[model samples]
Target: MSQHAEQAAAFVLHSRPYRETSLLVDLFTLEHGRISVVARGARRSGSARRFTLQPFQALHVSWAGRHELKNLSQAEVPQVMAPLVGKALLCGLYANELLQRLLQPADPHPRLYLYYTYLIQELQQSADLEGALRTFERQLLENLGYGIGFSHCHPGCYYQYDTQQGMIEVTADRGCYTGTDLLAIAEDRYETVDVRRAAKRLMREALAPLLGVKPLKSRELFIKTRRTA
Candidate 1:
């Protein structure tokens, strides 16, 4: 990544308190895939940026410094829409965690950035939240070159996913995914319960190796909330 940039289109993926009066913020920038910046004094009560630096808001950010963790020089959220609440907020956190964990630092993914922005914006009014998340997961995996290939899949056949070789044909009795479900997923069509269920499992399997052993806290939070509700 370059040492500095000004007024870049960005969104706050995550943030945490830093020292006594600053914040360590993670941003997803169009030019920089994922980055951390030190928001100096943004924790001060009177700082104008204290509220500006938040998730689910659009911002133009400026940062400078020669290190991997840059200093946030300026930030302003120009597109302040209604804040995400309830399940929508949880879904946003889940997406943030995925990007922060999977995306390589300083690697530019302009297409993935657009997908992410669309997903986040859609979550605000999305009636099909699970489908939206699955779509974004597919986009993220594809963007990272780990997408599950369905080229060899055929109708009326069964299949299973292998991390190393992608989708593989299998006998009906031994297969984890039905040909119909695979076909539906290939076309991004979740018209039935079976297809939706298969899509969720497929996404979990594809993301597992990339995510490793540590479980995502956002997922846990959402699951626990569901149990209580």
Candidate 2:
């Protein structure tokens, strides 16, 4: 109705109550990447926001503002996904946290959005959570410009990734890990237990270059679950 109103396709990545009756919503929009908007009076008992804040549900939202926190004028689910079960839900939350932390505001990444949508479907149907997570992690890193190199040699040399300098070439004096090993990871050939473990390690090593030494809390929780089981 208002000239200032604009609609965008989005998903509720996260939401929290503001001062009293307002809510701050973290949204991932198809055209705007990640955005934080204020839904005034949406926290009231019978407010529309109460019904529209569910995560991972497709949404069409109308918001207007000039500041970082825009005003929400409309919100609703456009298409609901098949419900995520058990650890899949937690995995989704972990993915949301990663996006929130790694992505810069207002940067659109439609490819990554598609990848995330496919990942949700995969998680819903996956029998191998570790495999799915490892694959997703690799994809996320690659999309973020931290892609691992598993191909080619520098001139007359051949070498494997050092996990520090990316890739080095083979020489007469020093032996290096081969592109074969790195490619195996890129291709998700986790057939053997050893290879599967190696895939996990490679991903972790690759993530280290970008994410640094600090561990993700969600990943730590997932690890503890495995240790106790």
Model 2, range 124-202, lDDT digits (tens) per residue? Answer: 7856666677777777777788877665633344454576677666653443444555566668765667556767666
Q: Which stretches of candidate 1 lie over 4 Å from their true place?
A: 1-6
**Candidate 2 has what TM-score?**
0.79
Candidate 1: residue pairs that collide: none
Model number with the top TM-score: 1
| C-alpha RMSD for every candidate | 2.1, 3.9
Clashing pairs in 2: 158-170
Evaluate model 1: give its TM-score.
Answer: 0.94
Off by over 4 Å in 2: 1-3, 153-164, 169-178, 188-192, 224-229
TM-score of each: 0.94, 0.79
- The lDDT of each candidate is 0.87, 0.74
